[model samples]
Target: MSSVNLMAREVAAKIVFYGPGLSGKTTTLRKVYETVRPAHRGEMMSIATEGDRTLFFDFLPVKVERVGDCSVRLALYTVPGQVFYNATRKLVLQGADGVVFVADSQAEAMDANRESLANLEENLLENGIRLDRFPLVMQWNKRDLDNVLSVEELRRELNPRGVPDFESAATSGRGVMDTLKTITRLVIKDLRAKRIVPPPRPAPPPPGSAPAGLEAQLAQHLHHRQPPATTPPASTGSTAAAISATPVPRTLTAPAPPRVEPAAVPVVSANTGSKVLGPTSALAPGDLFDHARAAEAAFIAGDYTTCVTACTDAVRRAMAFAGEGSLAQQAFLLHVDGSDLLRLQGLSTLPQLRVDDAAFALYVLMQVFVRLNAVGLPTAG
Candidate 1:
C-alpha cells in the first residue's frame, strides 16, 4: 500500500525484505540504510527476541528519488524468518507495495528458500495480493559463500516469473543497492499503473491572474465595488461644512484598531500526554478550522465529550475535503481509520474521559487543520 501527503509533497510506499532465516534480509536493509544519505534516512528500528533473531520486524524509512513533484519515501521492512514466526511474518507482509526475496544462495539452504517463497505467496494471498501480478524482485544472496547454488539454478527454482533478479553478498554490501533500486522502480511503476498516485497536479496559476472556473467566479463575487461619487455639501459657511466640502483624501479613512492575539489554549501533549499550550495561531477559514476551534473551546470549557466530538468532526471534514483518490485520503485510511469517524467516536465514550484524552484529541485535530491549511485548501464556489 502507498500513501501520499499533498501537504508534504511526499509519496510513501512499503517494501518488505523477505527470506529464510540467516539469508540476509536484515543485513541488506542495514546496508541500504547506511548507504543512504543521513538527511534522507530516518532511525532504523528492529525488534528482536532473546535469541537475537528479529522477533517482529526491522523498519527503515528512506527518501529516494522524486516521483513527479512528490518525493518518494520507501519504508523498508524485514519479516522474522524463523518457521515459528510465520504469523509475525504475515503481519509484516501486509500492505507491501513491493518485495525483495533475499534467497540464501548456499546449496543446503535451497529447501529453506523454497519454503520462504511459498510462505510469501500464501501470506500475500491472505492480504488479497497475487504474487504473480505484484511488483517483485529477487536477490540470490551469499554469493561469496562456498557450496552456493548458481544464479541460473536459483532463478529457475525461485524466480519463475523472471522478475528483475540480482546476485549479492549482503554482508559485504555487494549488489544490495541494485536490488533496492530495481524493486523501488518496479513499485513506483506499479503505483502509476494502479492509479494509486495520480499524475502530479498541474501547478497553480501565477498569483494575481484571474483564475478559471469556480475560483474566477469567487474572485468576481468578492471584488469590492467602487464607492459612488460623493456630492459636495451646498455652500455652507460653517467650519465643519467647509472641512467636509474640502474633498477628503482617499488615504484619510479612520485607522482600524489593533488586533488582539488570542492566548494559547492548554492541550495534552501527544508524546507525553501532559498538559501543553495549544498553538495560538489561527487556521484559515474552512470546516476543518471551525471544527478545530470548537474542539479547543470545548476543551477549555471542561467539556471533554464535546471536545472529542468536535475533534472527530474535524477529522471527518478533513478527510472529506481531501477527497477520493488523493494521497491525503489514502493516508487517513492507512494510518487513521478505514471507517473514518468510528475510532474517534469510541474515544468519546470512555467512562472517565480525562482532560488529557480530550485535550490530546483536540491537539491532534488542530495539527490536521494546520497541515491542510499549509497546503492551501481548495476554494468552494
Candidate 2:
C-alpha cells in the first residue's frame, strides 16, 4: 500500500510479493518504491542477507479511497521471498489482506518455482487460511528471459487451481501495477461480498423535527447495533424515545478529576526514526503520551473538559498516525478502554496544550488513568 487519500476515505489494504530466489521479487518492489511518490509510501523495511537479499521483506502501507459515501482504511504488508526464512514468511502472512506470488517463468528456474509454490501452500495451511479462499494472484515473473516457459505449460503444471495469473517482467516494472490492481479488485470484491459493513448512519434528526421517519429509523438503527447484552433489541422498543438519542447519563459527578499526575523520565527511540515530544522520550510512532501541559493548563485554566479532550485526541490521533497495534497503540488502548473516544458532559471536544520535549512516560501514565476511569459511557453515539 503506497498511499492514503483521506479526502476519498479509502482504507489501505496490506499486500505482499512472494516468490523464490532471483525471481525479481525484490526488483519489482524496488521499482515500485522508486516509481511511487514518497508520500504514498511508509518506512520501507528491507532486510538483506547473503543467501537471499530480502531477509525480512518490504512494507508499503497504502490506502485506497472508496468512491462510496463512507471511507474505510486497509493496512498492507509483504513477506521475505527467501526460502530458509519460512518462519518469518509465515509471520508476515498472519492477518494478511492479500498476496501476490511472483513465480519465475524461466525454464531453468522451474524447480525453484515449484518448491516455492509448495512452500506457500504448506505455510498458508499452517496459518489455517486456504490459499484458494484468500485474495491471491500469481505473477509469472522474469518472462523477458531468453528461454522462457510457455504460458500454457506454466498454467497447466503450476497453476492447477486456475487463478488470475499475470505475465510480468518485474525487473523493468512491466505488469507490476496490473498485478497490484488485480489483487486490489479481488480484495474489494471480497469485502463487498462479506456484507459486514452497514450503510452509513445519518446523524440524528433534530429535536421534534419533521420527517420523523429519519428519527424513527435512526433510533431503531442504534438499538439494533447496541451491545445486545446491555441494551434491549428491536422487538422491545416501540418508538425512538426508548432508544438513545444522545450519550448515556453518567453519575452527575465524576470524582473531582485528577488535580495532578506522576512525573517520569522521558524516552526516545532513535532507530525506527520519528519525532519525539513530552516528558517521556523514545515513545513509539502512532502512540501518544498524556498532554501534561494540556492537563496542567486545563486545571490551572479551570477547564477540566479541555484537559480531558486533549488527552482523548492525543490517544486517537496517535492511532490514526500509525497503523494497527504498534506497541504504543496497545498501551494507549488499554489506557483508554477499548475505544479511545472521550466526550465530557455538556462539552464539545476538549482541546489540548503541548507538553515538554521529554515527557512521554508521564504522558502515558496520565492517559492510562484518565481513560480507565472514563469507561462505560453510553455507546449511543
Candidate 3:
C-alpha cells in the first residue's frame, strides 16, 4: 500500500526484491545504492549469515523522484531467498506497493525459479492482493553465466502474464538500473490511476536530503511565457529561455460567455512533433492546444519546469472555458482532485517533475483542450 504521510507531505511506497536463494536480489539492491547519489539514498541495512547469504532481509530507502508537490520515496527491500525463509518473505511482503521478481537464469535453476514464483503468488494471495492486479516486473539475472536458459523460455514459465521483464547480471550492474526504473514507473502509474495525492508541506528538507540537483535545475527556468505557434530562432536557444528572457504573456481578449454546449475539438496526433492544430472550418485555432503542444516540446527538450508551467496554464484556461455544470469541468475536478491547481504555481519544485507526472499533466491538459475546442467561439482574424 502507498502511505501518504500527511504531516510530512510525502508519499512513500515499498518495492521489494524477491527471488530464489542466491538469485542476486541483494546484489541488485546494493548496485542501486551504489549507483544512486549518496545524498539521495539511505544506508543499506542487511541481515545476513557469516557467508553473506541474507538471513532475513536487506533494506535501502531512496527518494527516486517527485510528482507535483508530493515527493516520492521508495523503500526498497530484498527478502531472504532461501526456501526455509518463506515465512520471513511473507512478513517482508506486507504492505508492498510493487515487486521485482529476480530469477536466476542458469539452466539448472529453472525449478527454483518456478518455486519462487509460486511462493510469490501464494504470499500475495495471503496478503489479499490479486496476483493479476499487482504491479510486478521480472528480472532474468545471471544471464552472463554459461548454460543459462533463454529469456524466452524463462518468460514462458515465470511471466505468463508478460509483465515488464529485463535481462541482467547484477554483479556487473547491467540491467540493475533498468529494472529499478521500470518498476518505479509502474508503481507511479498505479498511484496516479488510483488518484493518490500527497499535499506538499512547508518543511525544509535537511541538507542533502532532496533529489540531487532537482531544486537547482528548477531554479534556472522558474519563469515561463506562452510560446508562439512556430519554434523560436537559433540565437534565442530553448523555448524556456526565450519565454523567460522576454517575460511576456500572450492573451486572447475575447470575452467568454457561459457555454451552454461544449465545442467540437479536433484530434491532433500527439506523435507529430511541432505540428499545430489549425483553425477549424467554424472555430478559430485553439491557443490551449498550442500551450499543450509547447509543454510536450519542452518535455522532449528536457525542460520539465517550463513543460509543467505551460501545462498548468493550459489546464487553467480549459477550466475557465469548461464553466459550471459542464462535463469537462467535472472531469477536470476529478482529474486534478480539488483546488490543487492553485497550489501548483511557480517552479520551486516543478523542475523535479518526473516523466510520469509530466506525461499525466499533459494528458489532463489535452483533455481540457479538446473540450474547450468543442465549445469555443471563433477568434477574430
> In lDDT terms, which candidate is top?
1
lDDT (tens digit, per residue) of candidate 3 on 160-246: 999999999999999999999999989988887787754343443444444235433442332232332454444656876676555
The CA lDDT at 377 in model 1 is 54
Comparing 1 and 3 on TM-score, the stronger one? 1
Evaluate model 1: give its lDDT: 0.73
Candidate 2 global lDDT: 0.57
* Model 2 weakest lDDT span, ten residues long: 349-358
The better-scoring model by lDDT among 2 and 3 is 3
Q: Write the per-residue lDDT of candidate 1 for residues 230-337, one digit (tens) a residue.
A: 557666678867676654322101232232112233344435657543352265244444455556645544456666766776666665556676644544643543
> Every model's Cα RMSD, please?
15.4, 15.6, 19.3
Candidate 3 vs. true structure, TM-score: 0.53
lDDT of 1 at 184: 95
lDDT of every model, 2 decimals? 0.73, 0.57, 0.70
As a whole number from 0 to 100, the lDDT of residue 232 in candidate 2 is 39
